[model samples]
Target: MTGCKVVAIGGSAGSIPVVAELLQALPANFQFTVIIILHRLKNVSSSMDTILAGKRSGIMIAEPDDKEVIEGNRVYLAPQNYHLLIEADKTISLDYSEPVHYSRPSIDVTFESVAQAYADKAVAVLLSGANPDGADGLLAIVSQGGMAIVQDPATAEYPAMPQAAIDRNRDVVILTPETIASFLHTLND
Candidate 1:
């Protein structure tokens, strides 16, 4: 692969630690714009962005505001109670529509949008989760000729999400948390 423009990661149960590990491995100057969609409770407040930022991984972690431009070297998280959509113009759009799979920040919604916005230049990673939300979205990425990586189910704390993706696309790349980071490094320009 030459270089990808964006890397969209989705996860739910038992994912925060894995996500932090992946982010920690990326160098401070990593060049791909990273969008992360994690299942969050609609009625509760979260300081996840702040918690991740406290890790001092050298990457800017934020919950993107509506219409914010997507930029490389930053990790954007979908805010609570909104479906994060990637616009064709490379801007973020938040939708307060009905939840998908009972989750507000639906991984499927973001992943599909990313597939449309970045097409072949996109990379989608489905991580540990208890539900099947990300499976279809991972397929969408693959359909667009983008790379789809699923966390090795054996290593995932909750295997349903990754396994669902694997079932949807047998050829999707499967990697452990450490290897996922290594593979992503190869895509950095």
Candidate 2:
């Protein structure tokens, strides 16, 4: 994981529990910046950052502002109704473009930007989702020589999302939530 500087996680339905589990498993000082894009309602207020910031994880979690610098060992959540993009200079930019696939904060939008920004130094994970939103983005990451990980459909609460990614990306690593957590914990070793 020497060259991998970012870990991009995208999910929809049934993703919160898995994300929490992964966060709990990851060491506080995990080297890569963790960017999360979870499909959320457009107008609803959110406390996702606080909810994910349990004592065990001890990681700083926040919703990123436009043009905010990306820092390692922190977790950034995509704000509702806005798409998140990573800049070449390791900063984040928020966009209010029309929704893709009927959703803003689209996983595909964030994943593709991260692939371009980090190239081979990025890892993208597609977790449980009801809709097939993250497939193309995960493929984009793989196409850019980045690693792709998909939740095992059998273990997913909703399999459509992970299954879509597996269908599109031949090199995706499929793992259960627990296994995925353990694998991620080794990134900085």
Candidate 3:
């Protein structure tokens, strides 16, 4: 999948550390676009974009803006208090809405949009999270012929997200933090 269109990674609560480890494993000029949808507080400001940017060498990290173009080598996070949906053209849609799984920037919404936007050219990965929000969406991606991966539920600090994906889908890669990074590096290769 050298020409894969996008890689969508999602997480929550325990996302900070998992995301850091994952980003460190990818090359700076990674071949595919990386979009992240981590649960965030609606009222509080998130430093995730800046923080991920600082930790990763070549991955440009920023919050998604409405109609913004998606590009490779950059990581886009859904902003707080909004659903970050995507267009068929790979542009972004940021909508302020009620929370799902009690999260404003819900992972399922992002995955669902990407499943539609990128179709078979997408990859969806779910990490540690406190809720099962991304499970259904991850399955949607798989149904659309996209690859789906989940962190090992047993190893995840919070396993709801990973476990949910497991229950909903089969043959999903379940990996540890370090191994997850290595796998991503290999996949992006």
Across 1-189, the per-residue lDDT of candidate 2 in tens digits comes to: 557789999999999999988888786578889999999988888888888886345688899999999998889999889999998898999999999888899999999999999999999889999998989998889899999999999999999999988988889999999988998888888
Task: Residues 2-75, candidate 3: write the lDDT tens digits.
Answer: 55778888998787788888888876567788888888777776787888888876567889779998877778
Ten-residue region with minimum lDDT total, candidate 2: 49-58
Which residues of candidate 1, in runs, are more than 4 Å off?
none
Worst 10 residues of 1 by lDDT: 51-60
User: 34-101 in candidate 1: lDDT tens per residue?
Assistant: 89899988788899899878765567899999999999888999999999999999999999999998
What overall lDDT, based on C-alpha atoms, would model 2 receive against the true structure? 0.90
Q: Which pairs of residues have clashing backbones in candidate 3?
A: none
TM value for model 3: 0.94
Which pairs clash (backbone N, Cα, C closer than 3 Å) in model 2? none
Native-structure RMSD, model 3: 1.4
Per-candidate Cα RMSD to the true structure, in Å, reads: 1.1, 1.1, 1.4
